[model samples]
Target: MGRKRRLITDSFPKVKRRKGGPGPGKEDGAPEPGLRGEEPCEEILAAHLDETHLEILRQFDLNRHFGPCTGITRLQRWERAEQLGLEPPQEVLKVLWAHPEDPQYQCSLWHLYPI
Candidate 1:
């Protein structure tokens, strides 16, 4: 008798996601408020977003978090978004450049105080 071959997919099963929401799970383009979490952020519910910002979001995260775009400062978000792939529009860069006071948001933002 021949041995049955084990496939790679057999080792990892895909997660079963709820049927709706803007997440990659069900919805295609934009996010709907998560059925489990708080109502989606105001920025998310707005019928229209700035065109350049819209382009940036579409490029930055296809599987975006359906929550507030807060916490991360505006500049940090744009800078980090570019690191992944796809540069945001030049207008975005210009706007961010005009405001240089943006503090970075990341795990390493705080250096330990010297003992």
Candidate 2:
């Protein structure tokens, strides 16, 4: 059998860590860089969310804990609901936005409840 030919390729690109300590779009105790110039959660919810979903969010005190400054992002909410065996209202699931800058609820928060 003939000897197999070898192939040469360029070296892999270097990976550089971000200047920030860790986590995406975060700095020390500062809001995410991408979230800058965005409205607070209250305003966004008030303006776009319907009364039913708003009321449901209120029932869980989600606004208080997960307000614009901090709370659960829409995606996280769905994940949390599944984790807690909760079936969130369809209307609540409909809430969407162009940005992922919304508040994020830590799973730990759900531990406080008896589920």
Candidate 3:
């Protein structure tokens, strides 16, 4: 009987790419509130926020004892959303910019803080 021969190959497993960075699905494109060239209304914005901001709100919504107050400011929220690859509604941004200190219901400010 002949001795068994071993095969040596240099092929190694490919390194899997980690899912990171802002992708298309979440990139901040134009705020599309399910319509064309139309501004997203409060309702649509709320829906979008609920889908995205739920988790973030939990972290930033401080003053828990005082009841669900947004820990961070409106500007922080907008920046976070943008960082997360989400396009904040133009109207929402406008509303926040108009009243940086005061919160607005249209931007879901009521949800995080008492407005």
By lDDT, the best candidate is 3
Please report how far candidate 1 places residue 91 from its true position, in Å: 1.0
TM-score of predicted model 2?
0.26
Better of 1 and 2 by TM-score: 1
Candidate 3 achieves a global lDDT of: 0.51
For residues 1-115, write the lDDT of model 1, one tens digit per residue.
5999999999998877667544454447544456435555675555244445445444433324322234554456556657756464556566456445533212112223232
Residue-level lDDT tens digits of model 2 in 11-47? 5665678774766555676765436467777776776
Output the lDDT of residue 104, model 3: 40
Candidate maximizing TM-score: 3
Query: lDDT of all predictions, in order shown?
Result: 0.48, 0.49, 0.51
lDDT of 3 by residue, 1-115 (tens): 5987655643565555448654556655655456755754787787786555443433333423323334555566666766766665555455455445544432344554455
CA lDDT, candidate 3, residue 9: 44
Say which prediction, candidate 2 or candidate 3, comes out ahead on lDDT: 3
- Stretches of candidate 3 off by over 4 Å are 1-69, 103-115
Q: Please give the ranking of all candidate structures by lDDT, highest first, separated by commas.
A: 3, 2, 1
TM-score to true structure, per model: 0.28, 0.26, 0.30
Worst 10 residues of 1 by lDDT: 104-113
Question: Ranking by TM-score, best first?
Answer: 3, 1, 2
